[model samples]
Target: MDILILAILIATGTYMLNAKEQRKRIALLGSHLANYQIEKLMEALTDGYLRALGESTDERRQQIWSLLSTTEAQLTEQFSRFAADFAKEPEATTRVSRLAMAIPFAEKILPSFTFDMRKALAIHARGIAHVVQNTSHLAPKDRAFMMTAELFLMQHTCHWFCKSKTIATARMLARHQTPHEQLVASVSADTRKAYLTLIKGG
Candidate 1:
């Protein structure tokens, strides 16, 4: 009876430890995958924005705008579904707020004739920061390095969006780069290479 009880306790302890570790990985991966999806969705919106600017005809602009508006709605619905599916115990409540901050495109994806570029960039930066902060609890060996790398990728995506719109607006948005670029530049070469590899789907 004593031996059986000891064995059961040992098994329970091991299982508990493994479950905790698995939860941590799941949270990290959920955040990472959500960020990736956000980036790709933004890329599509940016492409639409650039296409709208390049068109010389009013009819084409109307068509592009219609298509983009639909895309925006679809992206939001998809993100909401993704979050709901992953909102499990011990993470559900926290995940709700984290995903909101991390995604940050509930309304911003719908571009208009006179959209506020500065405000959009600010929201984008905040989204990236929130994701990094939320996942920091995982305590990776190089958390700062990894966060900065992710930030750099995000900033570049935002910069390209603005730059594609026009050089003048891009110049104006360039001032928003001080903090993100500084940390991004601090990452080691290997870390950067690794980021590139992961980003490229390698």
Candidate 2:
């Protein structure tokens, strides 16, 4: 009877340990799935932004605007969901890092319209990069993930910016005006300043 009781106690202990391990594994899996879903949403937003920029004709641009607006709404909804889900998890650092990384991509995907719009987008992008850099220092692994995300984010931003700028410049050429280099320069300068401020924690 003594031996049987000891064995039962050991078995119960072993079961509890295994259950704890399983819980940890499930939590980790949940975190990974959340990250994957956020990344997919970001990609969808980027694709929609690119599609909007590709529409050269005014009528097409209008249609693309509607689509892009809807995409933006969807992206916002996804982010909100991510935030709520992440709040219930222990991996707050990872969640914050993912959000920081996603900001640059979100800003990049915004539609460029007037000079003001371009400037706002550039400034916002720089600000987000700055924030990411600052927050990433707290978690090295998360920082690495953010850096990887930012690389692709910046690439897409530059691609869209260059294409849109070219079209604008061509249109200006047809109007017999020098391409508005000043506007680009000013916006670029503002973006750089915003990035510097972020780095300096200003």
Candidate 3:
């Protein structure tokens, strides 16, 4: 009976500590994120893509894509800056656990199971820049597909940092209708390679 009570207390304390740690990371990220309209841009691009894809007339579809091209460039520039600034943060503070579940002090306790988020953000930034800069190299359909995958994958990492890999994966499916594995597979080859390396602690 006494051991059971002790175990419950320990579990409760760990949960509180994990939540507190997550809040701190979220705040640190939010401070840099507040400077950019990333979420709004993402939403606009997503809706624009859908509208453009649904239009049957080539002329109207082309017009919609033309309008969204500017938005793509703007989002790319903003996210790149945000990633760069966030990377300036020390790696000690940016360590993310590879564990699927949130475990208090897991990052510190299992050093082998942690990865630096600075590298992850750098990977995402480069991926977005490549998709935007290679407009001529990729068809419109291909570009939109790759960009959506890249953004969803990036969002997954942000959620992972603030929460756990499990929660991140669940939210990705719930909000974007995309599974975590699908997001990884759908991203560009360059992104897939670099992101895989970073997450694997390479």
In lDDT terms, which candidate is top? Answer: 3
TM-scores for all candidates: the values are: 0.32, 0.33, 0.96
Whichever of 1 and 2 has more TM-score, that candidate is 2
Per-model C-alpha RMSD: 19.1, 19.7, 1.2
The numbered model that scores best in TM-score is: 3
C-alpha lDDT of all candidate models, in order: 0.43, 0.41, 0.91
In angstroms, give how far residue 181 of model 2 lies from its true place. Answer: 22
Candidate 2's TM-score reads: 0.33
Runs off by more than 4 Å, candidate 2: 1-37, 91-202
Q: Write the per-residue lDDT of candidate 3 for residues 1-202, one digit (tens) a residue.
A: 9999999999999899999999998999899999999999999998998998999999999999999989999999999999889989987789999999999878888988999988899899989989888744888878888899999999999999999999999999898889999999988999999999888878
Give, for candidate 2, the lowest lDDT window spanning 10 residues. 93-102
In order of TM-score, best first, we have 3, 2, 1
Worst 10 residues of 3 by lDDT: 134-143
